[model samples]
Target: MNSVYVDLAIGLVIAFLLFSLLVSGINEGLVRILSIRSKFLWAYLRDMLDGAEGKRSWIPGTIREVFARLPFGNKDARPKFDPLPPPVRSTATTWSGRLYERLREIDHNTSGRTSIAFVPPGRFAVAMMEMTATEGGVPAMLEQLRQDGSPLYGPLKGIWDSAKDDAEAFRKGVEAWFEGEMQRLTVLYRKYVRWVIAALGLVLTLFFSMDSLEYGKAILTDNAVRAQVAATADGGAAALERRLRDKCPEHPSDPYACVTEILASPAFVQIVGNAPVSVRIPDTGDPQWLWNGGDWLNRLVSPAHWPGFLVTFFALMFGAPFWWDILRRLTGIKLRQPDPTP
Candidate 1:
């Protein structure tokens, strides 16, 4: 009896693991397609550079202008911005206007690129140096900051004071500051990603009709089905574990390719085949086989199935790496357990 329950739990874990991988893979694809990381980085830089005093409210027009400047997406679709008049362009009086002109200069240097997806610490320090440049160097720059009434004046002054006029020390201080801010930014980005993962999990759960209760009952009641699922999971567990351990961060240029490879792997194929709840299109002569009105309606509105859908959704929200770790532990336990005597 205990062994039967163990088998059922293992089967469920394997199911969740597979589904989580699917959700994660789809999420990775979306991230790449939308250039989410790059956009987030750009937003962070905009806020940082503009400073509190220079910041503008994100009204509809402002939103449109920002959208037009992003480097990603359809270039032709972006709305054109009329060139500023010579006097206005040449004399950027306000601090915000000067910052904008500096960014424009940077963009021009980068072949008219409107947005920068990533900026290394050294490069950021260089940009800052250029932004704060004065004829008399650091002291003059500090005085300029005071005169301009820029919000960053305090922080810049502090950094400069600590550097004590050493150019190398000043650059390093700027780099350190950027690194510290980046750490905080990383945490915020992770939180945003969790919300995205949860949303994708919900969509995948509905699309696949992966009812946890139904799958659990099927595995628990049927000896043959349970045995098959357990066997398949056992066979493929090691391969899947290795695949999960392969870090995509090491291959940022094409992380989506790693996901695509996982989906195409034999282990994933086998596990997905053994999955009890899945969308399948029958090749039979019956034309109505694809459209099951009763099943669709039941899945849509049936309260009994709601709990199952919720279970699957939450399980997937746990993410692929999490379930892979569970799979490893459970597989170890299953192997360690003594087999029943005849």
Candidate 2:
């Protein structure tokens, strides 16, 4: 019983690590599909640019271009998908960096000494709005700001129009609206990732023929097969990990990246190299052993397969990293401890 339990543990750990990689890929895929980072950046900049007090503002071309690429960049498509963008680095060459350059440009024009990350919302609003303002009151100022016909103007104009005649009210309302949008963005990203994980997990489960339902009978009675799987599991696990070693980001900023990296890793997406190890059981016909009394029991099928599916899916939400962490610790301890069976 103990030996059989050890085999089960070995097989399960390997499965989890592989499956977690699949889940991670699905999560990242969804992020790319939505173009979440670009959308969030646009929302933030839209908030900063809105001013109803006849204030002038400047919108950088670089920032506007990125915004145009937002939410998949296809205005006419029902849902558009884009290739994943590179990670946002703090340097100016990346999307986030370009936005910073624009912020610095704004600060230079306004003679305000503020870092891009911590610029006050109201201060930014005044700078951007007033820059575009011309020699006139609200109507003339709005006309100058809206002249370029940039996509950003639509949202900014909405804020201006909502004021009717109250510039200060419009300013406050714009910031408030932006804050609400920020909150919604967080929730939206989370929900999107979860749905992706669930769908991908199910597909992977089927692809790998991890039909725990089908394997249950053999697992319960076939000691020889389990022993073979356990003995070879470490090698199989190492192979899988090697394939995944460069596939995922080692230290990702969020769940989305972690998942994407796992998915992108070089792995067998099907049951080719991913199947369980098998072994031949000794066929001693002599009834000298009690275990030989019922060889046919190995073929007995369990009707309760849903439990395996449910347990696997639920465990996967913990992600590949969580299981990998434990696997690492166990391996460390295992390396240091003397083998009991030895």
Candidate 3:
């Protein structure tokens, strides 16, 4: 019985610790991966726009000239090229329109996809990574186009680089704002984690202390627990002997079996919660155990469960943030701020 209570208490503490660790690791790891990818994309785009690479590619060039003349850009920069053969002309127009639609869809989706981990490394890192990669990719793409001998290559490269640059700059500015918020977020995360762990610790400690105190009090009071032992020495022992003699007149071993069976009766189950009050056995100075409907009534009404589940519920809720942070640190993941605009 003593060992059972000790095991229960130890199990509760261990379960709480494991829950915290699991949540923390998953959240932090996600943040770090997103931040890294965002920075890489940003730097690639910037490098493309600045023409850091030697030569401009043709496909991106033509697309740039077309969009540049849209209502948003310089209207005067519109192109005046000769008409193409029917098949070539139709293919070029269809491809160009499809490309335009795709770009627009991507721009719309970018707003919803932003994350927190990008803030810690700062906007400059994002910008440099994006610009360098895109600028470097242009020359390589141009060589592919030239070898493939694709017509309308000039327009494609023009539009691609211009549109790509604008997107890179906008993303950089957004990340810059998030960078300013990173410090504040870090402080808030720490405070929340500490508060939860402390609260859970306090509750768990109280539960164990209260359970121990109650058991100790029961033992010292000579209440229900004390009466059961006294019963055996009084009528309980004699009744066992009489029953064995009646059942097996010639069997000497039957008396010991009878005694063992009496000791292991259902009447000896522990008094859990509000059970029947122990009855005072007449002339024995010991209590006789009987069901009084108290245990059933208490089981239905009482909120307390064995060791008190109040401590368990609080331990779970409060421990979430602390566990989240520990996992983030171990995984080198950044905590992302919730998007302010959203």
Give per-model TM-scores.
Answer: 0.61, 0.39, 0.24
Residue range 1-342, candidate 2, lDDT tens digits: 776666555556666877888778765675555644444444444434332112422221343443344344443211112222312332322222333433444332222222232344564455434433422555664564467333445655787788777778667765665556556656754554455567677766544445443343334434553344456546755544443444345633343343344344312222222333222222345433222213222222323545665666776777898878767764554446676894
Off by over 4 Å in 3: 1-9, 19-180, 187-301, 318-342
Which 10 successive residues of model 3 have the least lDDT summed? 73-82
lDDT (10s digit) by residue, model 1, range 120-163: 67667775666556325677766776776655568778898899
Encode model 3's per-residue lDDT on 268-341: one tens digit a residue.
Answer: 12223234443434334666666656554554345454343444445555565554554455446796889989
Q: Residue 321 error for model 2, in Å?
A: 2.3
Q: Considering only N, C-alpha and C atoms within 3 Å, which residue pairs clash in candidate 1?
A: none
lDDT score, candidate 2, position 302: 29
| Candidate with maximal TM-score | 1
lDDT of each: 0.59, 0.47, 0.39
Better of 1 and 3 by lDDT: 1
On a 0 to 1 TM-score scale, where does candidate 1 land against the true structure? 0.61
Worst 10 residues of 1 by lDDT: 73-82
What is the descending TM-score order?
1, 2, 3
Distance from true location, Cα of 247 in model 1, Å: 44
Better of 1 and 2 by lDDT: 1
